[model samples]
Target chain A: MSSEAMVVGVVGGGQLARMLHQAAISLGVRVVVLDPDAGCSAALAGAERFDGTWTSAEDLVAFSRSGVDVVTFDHELTDPADLRVLERESPVPVRPGPATKLLAQDKLHARTTFAARGLPVPAFAEVATAEDVAAFAGEHGWPVVLKARRGGYDGRGVWILADRDAAATVLADAEGIPGFLVEELVDLAAEVSVMVARRPSGERRAWPTFVTTQVDGICTEVILGGDAGPAGLAERARELALDLAEQAGLTGVMAVELFVTRDGELRINELACRPHNSGHVTMDSCVTDQFEQHLRAVLDLPLGAPDPLVDAAVMVNVLGGPDPWDREGLTDALAVEDATLHLYGKGHRPGRKLGHVNAVGATVEQARTRARAVADALGSP
Target chain B: MSSEAMVVGVVGGGQLARMLHQAAISLGVRVVVLDPDAGCSAALAGAERFDGTWTSAEDLVAFSRSGVDVVTFDHELTDPADLRVLERESPVPVRPGPATKLLAQDKLHARTTFAARGLPVPAFAEVATAEDVAAFAGEHGWPVVLKARRGGYDGRGVWILADRDAAATVLADAEGIPGFLVEELVDLAAEVSVMVARRPSGERRAWPTFVTTQVDGICTEVILGGDAGPAGLAERARELALDLAEQAGLTGVMAVELFVTRDGELRINELACRPHNSGHVTMDSCVTDQFEQHLRAVLDLPLGAPDPLVDAAVMVNVLGGPDPWDREGLTDALAVEDATLHLYGKGHRPGRKLGHVNAVGATVEQARTRARAVADALGSP
Candidate 1:
């Protein structure tokens, strides 16, 4: 309660950290980011940057002691073992602790944890060889999903195998490595995600569920509305997310990616234990955006309302193209009715996420059209 | 432009500049601020802060040449001669230039300029002696308003005189100095302000007129609604602001304060040639906030829509109180329905502006009550 503002240290300096720095400015909170990349998105906002990698315990512990009140993450890239060292040595507490972050870092660990905790998850089995995958496919049907146990994101260490031959090809591509994880491919009616903010006090709130669209395993758009997909499921999705959030012991904002099956059941897909791209729709519509909510949660301050201020909102991701991200259409993007554009200060590479456009209106279709217009004007990849 | 984000140099690091830094982070723009105080409000945002004063011509010119695409003022504190040097010597354009900024720095000059251009203004006069004050009072009324010709804000250097006796007391207090300006104290109605963003290309846009409430010469609350004041004068106010924006050649956001007469004419009162406090309401309610609009305008990219996204919104200034500002209530303030709190990182001193809370709703009264509640929770001065 002193006059000095609270300082929050972020582990990664990506778009989440960048948006957190922006939100912190108004709260009078000082944000310090420890990212090895000096030109990281957050460094552009002037968040005092420390040159350190998130995975290095020595750097994280050293960075944590340098006047931070608490430490949080923008991504789950830190080794849980390293973070345990941080929690032991640092003066301030590490949010989500090692256990929660372990779930985010290791997919096989999270699936087992969810299963043991009675949380809904797709049928799965940890595999160590192609024969194990073949057995799981025989039980759960073909077109199984193969996933790395750890350190893979944005569709990178994931594979879809139609049968034993395809599974053999994936194993061969991986130099015949036997270790990986496989799961039953749900009859997905739609893909949805929910954002939850939980403090150590066990105080938590959930943002409206978002129905997402994916292309080639990468999220392309996020939509928020009363009837975005399967009828009357938004409230149930939020409840499901909150229940799993408690099980995950998530701190700050966590995105619970879920698969809504055609059989009317919600099955957990993956856990993103941080402010996520799917929640980007909240930035332009929610009463308190997820970035601010994350700060409040980590600081253990009173939580903010997670409800949207608009009827519907949607966000379209802008990816880098063959040339480069053309910000020249910024004016035209702003000209789109009810559209707001946000571009990350990053160098363009083909198919890389450069930024996003959010639009709000009375209906999902109306919002989606305007948001698409802005992304198209910006030459969306 | 070649995949490069534009850079802007702001001459002052107050709350306006701080808010601009927040807006620019999302736009991928770089902001460089020149301020002598290492701990100015904007410095906390991590904008690259240059150690310099706004008044020094050497500093102004040097800061502008530091690879800025355009230079803009957060306040009109720069000496006009000094800015003229910056305009001539620096590669970047000085928006609102020396001539436009001079009018903001010198009120007497603005009144005279508005008078000459046939703009709506109260009857006024230039006075250098007690006799001149008496002559203006004789024509206008017994009681008149006196203001300093330049360098005054937030209730400083302004006096309301009752008669010759009161006038004599003010003169004696000033040691017989008579170099000031005087105006007729109009029969009261209401006070309102409009913000305009004009690009060098002559493209301009005006935000909705805000009816503001002042307490002892300090703006306490700003209300935005069609019926905020007597009858419907918002449209007329916007037109008048746009007209003066062209006359002033202002290439960024300009706030024009106006006084409504008991009978129904809006007379121009003051000009703030940068992002002004009256437009702070736009941050929470408008499609394009004034801070972002200022960047768009000064960069000459394109003017944004200045319309409010909500039906009505209101902002209450949180002034420093008896103790230091209690950001402890940040949680409760945010809990106020539809309220968003913004705190300027300031060392609190009684009567100094600290920050503001904005709330939006279906009606002005609804928004005001919520905004007031948030301000009260924050221990508003």
Candidate 2:
């Protein structure tokens, strides 16, 4: 019955893939996930599976060759070499192609690329030895940020050094690891993210900029469509994001995380080539959600309107609580009628993200209050 | 990992079940379908299958016993006796229980029951022979409607007779049918439908009445939140529907199809005990869609808000066309970005319901115009 239907193969069976599968079903499209775990999160969503590890070139190539019209990703964790092999051997194309992924998978590469394209980024340089760290800090500042070039996500592989002692402690701890980058830490202000989707046909659309809240370097909240900043800042943020998408040759949704200094200067912080936590607000607030737009872009279909449908929408993350399970908390969370809750169906692990609550209102404060209440009621049990 | 999760078993695995599975996935709930056709529409949505038939008591009982927390339905086509058997033999509860389903299954039972409860219905009588139809017509009018007591849907098993000869022809054609009903052909100024979701706890929520357009007997379009009628007519329709739901002891979503006569009277026409076609507009317009609401109602979860999120939402059905398949038409239809399209993964069959398009706007006319354009562009392939 689906002989002529479009099929997309996703690299990781995570929450992003689960949502992609959900969005695809309404359009009569099929999503197949490739993952090593047979019971990954996307499996609960009933996504078809191709059992394989993203780290292996053989697995990547086989999955790409298996009946899918296009290949995509839930995360940028696949090995660059493996993706290169898949690109050369498989008939299907891998979206957000290997080159763009390198710009996400390798922080140093992303920093260099953004800087080269006239995108504002912090002063940065590669450093490995004690002398290297000291020389960079001497030029920039004493307190600096240390980051690994690859294999980092969700606050992992990152260290903030305040002074000599802190810098020495981190350098000693990272004895043998090779790739490293150091950057000057700027004065704290606010954090924001802009998500944009690009199609292979050069069509691109951007969701409005969202102000985000971070706890321990993890996104805790995202507020969309509220002009809580200086005039023209959001518009400039969108322009920067769209320009980055074009420069990276992006073919799917990409989240451009940015930092606003105390003096109102915007600097690029990080890049995620797939759906990011910040885009969750679009699930309820925008005409086209990030997940659906990602699918449309990968399938080479017309991009959906990225404009907000409501005045404001807020999304609050739900982390696993201290208890083994809290069925009552789940019920209580759902009772917040104005909010929409999404549980990822993963088993509880304290401090781990398990779900999120979204609410839309006439103002950012109203939506944020409702979302916060739902998240609090869903407190770790 | 999901040993504590809730599972719902659906009696039919059609488009309704497909959408239920899609909705449940976001809430960490699982939906299992019992259908003889392993490749039913719900299967495309990744719903688990029970490998049974709705018409078989053994199949239903075994499915209900298969570790499900609740047993629900996609359509009212399940055999009432089979449902009763499952209720008596299985541990799970059957929502929209056997008693309520009997009213939807048998036209005579629904008419007599509605009339007995002081609800308005056209003058109707049981008819099994030519004399029965003729005698009822003589009292009511020359033109009447002949309907089977059971097994009728989408214009099937119904006949409009203008004279004695026409009534005689229908009586002859329905020779083996054991039961039938004859009703006065009331002058219909408009057709409307109101959908209500009732939990086993007696908590009921109703969607606003929708003005629907029908081609033959199939609903072709639905418009919500339009004040096109006399003052207070929509509110009255909702009250009547809520009252009927209570009278039927409904435990799930029920669509009350009604006829607004030229004489300014509201009369119930037909009863659907599961998600009905008219409620499709809620999928995009209301805060709580019928599919998700049906799952929540059956699961006995706190009901979500049912108010409209937009000023207006319109849905237009897409029928299959002359060609074997029209991928180009599908693309053209989707290019109408203002409308959201849902295409059931069914093979081409001329005049068959292929899918639907839903659009929300500032006005009913605007939404309807966009929806109609999508449906027209998706013209039969």
Candidate 3:
């Protein structure tokens, strides 16, 4: 806002932070990272890192002392009360304050807010008892989806209740966690996500939503410049995301996941208030990469053009298999022409997200063709 | 020769290493950097750094321990004897070796090599005595160029003998330096540099030669994809550089600095056997940047397409001024649309290489127009 390079203090030590660091370098800004781990990916930029957690008030005060221009996150699990307190005494601004971040952090709150706004969403209700789950499933005709309200990711807190019997089994697993939400399982044609950016000044820009393919409930690939539904569906989804961001007072990057049902209607599925994997392909395919756009939005800089630079771009997640000790496997995958491999610098474990690979070419099929080859190399025994 | 990523070990820590680092990232190859300074630009890539003197065998041995696929340099001033000894125990290979590197390191050797090969070079002789200088000056007329055989840069190791009295004053500066060479000064109309890359398999690729302008002997700007002179001049410059590379057995990026004289003849002014600053504009303008080409050649990877992406590109060097500070002024300059800035992360000093800014657009004049604004911002008092 002051026409100076804004210093962003990012909390979390992961690949997201690492990429944000790279984007900040190009903009001539410094990123200060707060992570307890020394080998965090963001440390490669040589950004100042305080060894601590986001919930530590001492750590927050130390971060505040670093002369940061703003405070943001690589992941959206920050304590709302902590953020609320920090905003009162912070040296810099905190984005998506307690009131708004809750809409993303708490799944039940997000569903309620969406339904309250008359947005098209699957019929869902907060479930605290077996009767609540039974009634919702009975009304929805069966096989309802139950999800934890918080602290869930990568399909971990979600379960599909085949019937009342299956609901009881999953209820034992959801034991002490916050209240679960029961939603009618819409017979969806495909799952897609639209990534959008918004400045505090009310400016919004959307990237072309892409159909996503998943494996074992984890996102496996993202194909840009395509929506399984009609062209208008993508635009409609983008409009919904923008309206939701404005209503929720969301700043920076926000992702709206959508499901296109058999009737061709777009319904809100889930939401992430920070940069999402669905937008990773933008790093190579878009004129202005999404991570950089997030930094610009958070810093309140003028938004940049978000047009696609290629016809289509496909991104495939590189998951770690058992005994994932091979480096050449990844290198061999990269040898394919026009393929870019990004390793997340994480130790490998089965089903863990080590990194992702992106390919851009003449068509979605062409990009996906190359992307499959890269994914095979990662999963190769 | 294998399809494995060839590990290139580059010696010296400067802006060249920084660009080379960026190039290596695109190729998915690891570069081991040996620089005495911890803050060397190439260190940004997490390139293994052995911070020690060029003459230290311990440092050389440390570099050889992990085994490099090929050892090259960002600076050609490395001691030839030391390099030759290290090659024996090298884990992988060293490109050019001591013999070829010396040609670029010593002006006397370079001139003799060119003369013996019957290549076009200015009339010159080693000035061991005043008679040698006087005879050459008498035959060539006034305004001969005097250059030290080693250890000089940015016009510091060379002098212009405008007249007999001026020659006497310049001769004193070259006194302590070894083997000074005197050459007839050509009435140069323009300066251009030809950048060519040679592979171990005798494959060679040449980038479009561009006109280079210098201020105070430091490269100030590059006009990429421009017709520096006539078509014939560019062809001749390319041919001369290729011939020089083949003759010297150079197997990496070679830059030939040429002078187009009033008579329309091209003469080799100097040569650099590394990623030259004159090619920096290629990073933003060329389809395959010169650094990527250098990495390809050194790694023996399949060369990439080297066509120009934009019609024109201009590179403006950010030389340090009397003040030590961040590039706030330079950032302000990039407020112009379509400008890309590359900072080397070096400490500020008077007359030091800090970083560079580039602009690529539809026309040479347009690119230069925008580039000058950024450069002016960086160098403004």
RMSD of 1: 2.1
Per-residue accuracy of model 2 over B1-381 as CA lDDT, tens digit each: 222568989998998899899888878899999998877889977999999788889888899899999999988887777878888998988898999998888899999988998889999999878898889988988788999998899988888998888888888887667589999998988889999988887888899899988888889889997763677888899999998889899988999999988876898999999888999898877777888888888888777777777778899987876654466666666667667878777766779887788887788889888888777776642
TM-score of 3: 0.82
lDDT of 3 by residue, B1-381 (tens): 011344678877676776675455434355668878775666643455766756676677677665677777888777767877777767766775777778888898889988888888888889865567788988888778888888767777877877766666766555578778999888878999988888787877778888998776777878886776765888888888888888878778888898888777888888888888988877655545678778777766545545554567788887676664434564356455566667666656766776777786668888888877776667632
Every candidate's chain B TM-score: 0.96, 0.97, 0.93
lDDT for A229 (candidate 2)? 66
DockQ per model, Cα: 0.52, 0.53, 0.17
| Clash-forming residue pairs, model 2 | A321-A380, A323-A381, B321-B380, B323-B381
Order of all candidates by TM-score, from best down to worst? 2, 1, 3
Question: Per-residue lDDT for B313 in model 3?
Answer: 78
Residue-level error in angstroms, candidate 2, position B282: 1.3
iRMS of each prediction: 2.5, 2.5, 6.6
Instruction: Provide the clash count, candidate 3.
Output: 0
Worst 10 residues of 1 chain A by lDDT: A170-179
Pairs that collide, model 1: none
Instruction: For residues A1-381, write the lDDT of model 2, one tens digit per residue.
Output: 323568999999998999999888878899999998877889888999999989889999999889999999999888888888888998988897999899899999999888887789999999876678888999998788999888878888888887767767787887555589999997857888999999998999999999998877889999987663688888889998999999999999999998888887899999999998999888866667899889889988878777777778899988876664455666676677668888787887878888888987788899988898887876642
Local accuracy of candidate 1 as per-residue lDDT tens digits, A286-379: 7788898899889887777776777788899988767763446666776687777787888877788888888888898999999998877776
**lDDT ranking of the models:** 2, 1, 3
The whole-model lDDT of each prediction reads 0.84, 0.85, 0.74
Winner on TM-score between 1 and 2 is 2
